[model samples]
Target: MADDRRLEVLSAIVTDYVRTREPVGSRALVERYRLGVSPATIRNDMAALEDEGYIHQPHTSAGRVPTEKGYRLFVDEVARIRPLSAPERAAISALLTGAVDLEQVVLRTVRVLAQLTGQLAVVEYPSLRLTSLRHLELVALAPARLLMVIITDTGRVEQRTITLMGDRPDPGDDGAHGVIDPVALERLKIRLNASLVGRRADDVAPALAGLAEQAPSDERALLAAVTGELIAALRPDAEERIAVAGTANLARATPDFTTMGPLLDAIEEQVVLLRLLSGDPADASGMRVSIGSENHEDALAEASVVTAGYGPGVGDAVAHLGIIGPTRMDYPATMAAVRAVARYLSRFLAGPQD
Candidate 1:
């Protein structure tokens, strides 16, 4: 365990330096912060901290800045995250309560997170597969064709058409007789659902093929269309939609946004963003602060990330939420705001019980 007094002093120095964007010296710390010690005493503490590699002097003439180790200790031991103010909480609750759909929920979440943290915020949409199956409707358009509509708990809807074989002897235009009865159609729907319902689209085809051998002679086309459409709608090839807000904030903090062209380029890539966010689900519960030079990504080597995972719990991360900002960004405020937003988002996504 670190010394409480030292940790408190280090925390105070980090908090102060982040705000001023300048190195912190013993004299400034002593005079500015009531450390209950003289400049000389504080100077000795600073030297000891520097020797322990918790802080560093950027130049021989400079004061000191927190090193990555310093940040780690601060985050793990010294940081005290606070919830949002009641008014802010109420506003966030109202905004989230009005979300009629998942897209709106995620969009609003990213915006709210950005506003709170003053840093870039990214939110991944909840996967469709995880959503509860609300209802399924089947409509027969022709003897051989049927349309199937699937509604999810998240309020999103998908429709697909299934083609079935016709019992009509002519197999074509027979104006005199309408083939396929309502009873048969209902039975066919029941059969198809037995193999398809609640299962992922990709896994449905093989399951449906099992029932094909026993399918009604005239409903083969309808079955095929229903199965094909369901598969297409849930296809993993569909681009996972994610919402990003606060790039403007990112530009405002950095001194040379244009010069960091490569870094900006990587941030824009969806795959890269997804990989970065989803890289470690286990690290999601509390705030995980990656200071400059501590991040593994080459593009973000000079940047800092303060992130947390939000889901059912730490083990079942439903999604990721975090802020990306400069290393000099306010850690305490940013971290507090992030923790609040993450908890709020998790509650929003879980929604009220039906």
Candidate 2:
């Protein structure tokens, strides 16, 4: 019973401190919350919490504020991370559903997240290597020019324009004009799909290595150009990309940070943000929270990050999204916003594309 009451006092301190950005005294806690106990008893509980390293008094005469330990305990024990309200869910769904492609979806998602949490938001784009090819379309724009459309299972689409080169004109074309035969273009499309559809992005190039050789002599040059572009599109060294929003929100919490320069610089470095978001594995609730000193970067020492992975299903995270703010943040609401947005994004990616 004593332990439980102490936890309650700690929770109340965390809440009041986060809201007011001020040290909470036992008297204020008693008045603000009905602890069902006398002021002296609350003071004793506060003393116990402080001794245990969960909270501390910054100034000898001032009231108490929660330490990082206290915040972690509050997040793990006392905070109830509830789902977003029906209207909130509807709003997110409506916003995400309107996106036309993968790029738009990511941009819109980061904006929505930043708005919901009032904090800096980061979203890692789905890794191409993890996605399978869903469809491939080839259109003959002209005899020497073709449009190649590649669609992935995660609804990512890439288009490339290939210019045919070599000594041969298409089968039905006069030597004067570099026109491709319609019948041959259609046949190449069918063959390319047969050889490459459903393969992982990393395997695309290898699967198409001998494809040009298999085509008829007159069509080999066109096939080779198309395959080369496809291979380049799915190169292994392709840099991973991330989207970020709400830097102004960080500026609002300037008082909480020791120095804002390093933090701001780190945010601009995509590689740093990606490593931070993906470093920690999530907990049972599909959430990962890094508080204060737990963060790897010196720039983030005074900040907290809440992240959740999103993908087609459980244990299949293709990428992650999260928020960064001062350690004195509202953990419950931030966790809920991250979880909710991640769920919506997962459903969006798993669904069929237009």
Candidate 3:
């Protein structure tokens, strides 16, 4: 266990350093924190902290900065999330309430987070397996060509077209388009339901055998298109992660041009960003904050992330929400806003009209 006074002093140093983006020294800490101890005593404690690898000096004579271990300890032991002010809360409510559709909600969420944190923000679309099948529509374009559309419980849409080849052209139905009888449409609906209903779209292969047995001539082509669309729609593309707002804010930090350029490139790499934010919730509820070097990626060494998991009302897939920002970010305010935003999203998506 860390000593109470020592932890207090360490927390103070971290908070101050994060705010100023400068190393914090014993004299400055004593002056600012009123630790009821002499500067020499604080210096000794600082030395001990450095020895324990919680803090380090950027140069021999420079003040100390928190190491990854230092940041982890501070977040786990001393961080306090402040609630948002009334005006801020009102602003958030207005932004969320104006969302006309699901896409708008997500896009607005990303923008709000970036605006608040001044760092890169990201919110991944919910995974497909968690979404229940709401509706499926099939339209016959010709005797053999068909178009299929599937809508999920989350309002995500997937569409595809299938083409079938036949040995004979049936030109009897008013032209060469052939016949699309009610029987064929009913059969197609049954095949779609069998393959997709109540099952994760990814697990529909075994069900395809039944479709093949009944519609052997066109089954393969139809299955291919349907399966392709389902997978494509459900999965997040590698490029999607980098599509974010607020890269300009990162420039305000005191990073050298070389460091800044690479950092920007790294942020544009969606795979790395997803991997960084991909951890499961640490506790049962509420929010989790990772500060500075506590992050796994070296590119995020100077940054911090605050995240949480939410769901849609009684039962739904856990939705991850949070902000990524410089370590100096206003934690209490950010955490409160993030929590509020997440709860609003849950309610908004679960409302009767949505």
Candidate 4:
């Protein structure tokens, strides 16, 4: 019975400390929670919890705050993470309703998520290597410039611009009329799409090579020129990127001038921020909650990360989305928001292309 009451006391302390951002006293716990106990019993429970290292006093005369271990226990056992309310779901849906394309959807999602979570939201762009090509478009914008648009089955659209030598003549033309021919462009689009559709980014170059080799005399050079640009655009190293928003939220939440530099610096570094999210192929459907020092990044030692994986395909495919905030944040609420946003993103990606 004593152990049960002590755990209850510890839970109250953690909850109050997270909400108030101050060490909670026995009297405060008694006033805030109906624990059905006397103030003397609550004080004794607080003393026992402090002795066991679950809660610690910040100063000689102050009350107690929960340690990382205490927060972990509260998160894993005591705290109940509830789902988003109907109004929140409607708000999220209303915010994301009219995005024009997948890129716009991904771009808006991070910002909407940041607003929803009230933390720095980061979302990794879906991996090109893992997605199959759905379509490809090439349009000549100038005598020598062409825009190439690549669309993938996972609703990701990537684009690149290429240049052709203006002085070169068509292979079948008798004159050096270097300007692009619309008829030739249409033929190239059809030829490229036949080979590229359903092919992954990594396998695209070889497929392009095979198609170019089997091409007719007048089309080989055009095919090779277009394929070169497509190969470069499809390189995973060149196109790997992420979306981030809500830096102002971090600035607003931070009060200590000493922590401002490292925290803001971590948010600005793309590689550092990308490594902070734990979702990948293996953790495609799981969540990673790294609290304080658990993140292993020295700058992030004073913060916590709540990441959840979101899938864009029907199979075992996914990308990561989550937020960063102070270690004393409300875990259950933040985790629930992250999870709800991830679910919404998955539905959007799985639904339709546009």
- Name the candidate that leads on lDDT: 2
C-alpha TM-score for every candidate: 0.78, 0.85, 0.78, 0.85
C-alpha lDDT values of all predictions: 0.70, 0.86, 0.66, 0.78
The residue-by-residue lDDT of candidate 3 on 1-354, one tens digit each, is 378877887888788887777899988998889889889889988988889888899888899988767777787777666677787778677888867766778788778777776666677654455566667787888766777776666555556675554435433322232345445566667768756776654455555545655554433445445555556655544123222666677776645232665566777776766655556454444667776556776777767777765556553544566767676665666777777777777776676643
Cα error, candidate 3, residue 155 (Å): 2.3
CA shift at 259, candidate 4, in angstroms?
A: 1.4
Listed per candidate, the RMSD to the true structure in angstroms reads: 4.8, 3.9, 4.5, 3.6
Residue 134, model 3, lDDT: 65
**Residue 78 in candidate 2, Cα distance off native in Å:** 2.5
Off by over 4 Å in 4: 1-7, 36-48, 165-181, 256-258, 279-285, 314-317, 352-354
- Give per-residue CA lDDT, model 1, range 1-354, as digits (tens): 377778877887788878887899887887788778678878888888889999999888889988877877887788766667887777677768878866787788899889878888887765555544456678877764567877654454666666554344435432323344566567777776666666644565578788776676555555555666766666666555578999999888776232566667878998867666666433434557776566677888667787766653334444567777776677777877777777777776556756
Candidate 2 or 1, higher lDDT: 2
Residue 31 displacement (Å), model 2: 1.2
lDDT of 2 at 125: 86
Task: Name the 10 consecutive residues with the lowest summed lDDT in model 4.
Answer: 278-287
Error of 3 at 268 (Å): 1.8
